[model samples]
Target: MLVSFRLPLLNEEMDINDAAGIQALLEQLRSSQAWQEAVALPTAPNEPNIVPEPEESNSAPSASVAELLSQLRTEPDTSTLDRPSEPTPSLPKPTTPATPHLTPLTPTAPTADLSDLSRHLTFQQALPVIANLSGNPNLIQTLKSVRVLLTCLLELMFPSQMKDEQHALETRLMEERKAIVTKYEEKVKVAKTKASMIGSGMSKHEASMLSGAFHKELKSFDTERVLTAWDGLVSQQQDALSQLGIPIMFASTEPSHRESQQKVIQVLEGLL
Candidate 1:
């Protein structure tokens, strides 16, 4: 009887336990006559003598391969070849690196012209302009013009050091107004004190009488005299401005005079 055995080929994917079983199976076959015959088979005389050189395999096996060989050698069981192997846990997939976020730069605002700021200047703005122009010979005309304009505006607004007649008239009118207010205030205070002493019964009637007297005094107060004094003060300022060649029109209505003054200020500001 002819005996034949089929052997499976070993590959990298074969489990270490399975490889050990295959190695044991090969050992069993080594004692068989057919294995002995196959190993003793003679080569033809013309065929080259093939020899494996240790120097050709001088390079070491990779770590994975060495580790597989180690596992196979350590395992003693051959029956495990018939059993199913535990599945290997899969490795996580590599993630793409996140792109870095960048904040966009803000564009700068346009620079404003220095001269454009003069449009909204108050009377106090003159001081800085005067200080800057001082000691500069080339700006003498500008300095003089600004000084005169500022002086005119100040005199028109405050009206100090009036002519002898105008000053006396204003003083007299102010005194009269003060006297009227003082007299009424004194009377109201007396009436309030008396009512408080006499109790609430007569307080209402006293308050009504005081109120009437106060209103009568206020109505009698000469507002026309104060207006006349102001008009005289303005007339004096107009004369002063004319002497300085500022030529503010006192004869014009209040609104017209204000408009003219604004025009003059604009012209003076342009000179700077």
Candidate 2:
């Protein structure tokens, strides 16, 4: 036996495999106004529905607005607002007067006298006197003649007294000589004591070497010879005075007289 079966279909249902039918149905729904209104899509939540209002005609402001604007346009009382509560007192500044500048005057040097220079005075002290007398030849000659006369008179009147004064000067010179010798000898003794103390801490050879050098220095330290040399110089000066016929005793007498004699002697020697 052969049997055939047919599937049942609904009147409102469409076949899922029928593309043409579905497209035609969509076109019909789009064309129908009633269908479009009935099934309209909802607006998006982010999109606002704004309606523009109509513009009003040009006119003046209201009475209250006009009064408010007039009040704003009026000027404020700045004088009262800017003023301080109390007025401040101002003090005057003190001024200092300028002092006058003064120029100082130069001082003049004092004049020196020829009679003030002496043999007891140093070469430095006699320099001014010598300079003053240098130009006056007649005055110098007169001084020399006076000194010669005075010296002759002194020698004739007090020969014994002059000799005693000369002896005293020699004695003083000898005492100075002894003092110098004693000073140098004390220095040598001190050097020897220092060397001995230092040598205690040194090698024998080094100590001996130092001792030799120290003794050699002492040998060359002849203070006695220096005194003798000074004595020779004094002797030479005395011999020169004797040759010139001027007494050494005259130098120890009146300072003014000795000064004049010295000045005359210096002039004569310079001429020679």
Candidate 3:
């Protein structure tokens, strides 16, 4: 078919030069099955291995001329014959995984430990201590015991020039102490004098008769008992107060364990 068309173009001098005839010939060339079938490409190597049935496949171009003519005479089996064997579709290409935006580890400050202990004074209040000190003029032993405890508390709470203030406070304390002790001492002394009057230069009957009006107040929890208890109690209390004030590091940051320190607060408050 190609040889037949080229023969006319090749013989230029004997060319079919009428424009109408040439246009008709070109239109006929476009509608020709021979031209349409000229590009009968082979099945690709990657084609499916399925051997299609006779119904599914077209007859090869090498088929008999009669069968080819028969196929052309009929309307095409459009469903099977119209579409291309190979189809190309545009698709979005998959992209490379973008660099994982590594978030920089933020360095954090230590959390401020707002504990109950943190808000409290590291030592006892001053007024109650002063009032107790002022009352006991002759409470030499009690003051001595408490003074040692107070000295420790003061030194720990305020590392300032406490020694300077101690001298002045001690001087005044001693005067108050002496005056109180003396008052109690004189009262007891007068009581003794009246008791001594009972044992006058008279007989036993006269002493008994005079003693009828005499009376005495028995002591409550004694000074000795209080002092003994004070030693142990003071030591324990100081130890507790010291423990509460001290800062400690824990082994874990689990949320459940964070409130464990409140246990210490409860126990300390109970003791106080």
Q: Tens-digit lDDT track for model 3 on 1-272?
A: 22122223322322244566545544554455653454344555887644333234553532322243233333445777877777677687999989999999998855764433243322233233333534544333222223222221222221113333444445554575565556656655665677679884445664454344222111222233333443343344334333333222122233332233234333322322
What TM-score fits each model?
A: 0.33, 0.20, 0.21
Scored by Cα lDDT, where does model 1 land?
0.49
Residue 249 local lDDT, model 2 = 19
Clashes of each: 0, 0, 1
Better of 2 and 3 by TM-score: 3
Best by TM-score: 1
* Per-residue alpha-carbon lDDT of candidate 2 for residues 118-188, written as tens digits (9 for 90 to 100): 43455455455556655667544433333221232222211333344545655676675566566656755
Which ten contiguous residues of candidate 3 have the minimum total lDDT?
Answer: 151-160
Best by lDDT: 1
**What is candidate 1's TM-score against the reference?**
0.33
Clashing pairs for model 1 are none
Candidate 2 versus truth, CA RMSD in Å, comes to: 36.2
Ranking by TM-score: 1, 3, 2
Question: Each candidate's lDDT (Cα)?
Answer: 0.49, 0.44, 0.39
Candidate 1 lDDT tens digits, 117-235: 43234435544654554445544443243222222233222123444445476578879888887887887787767767878444677768877887676665554556555555655
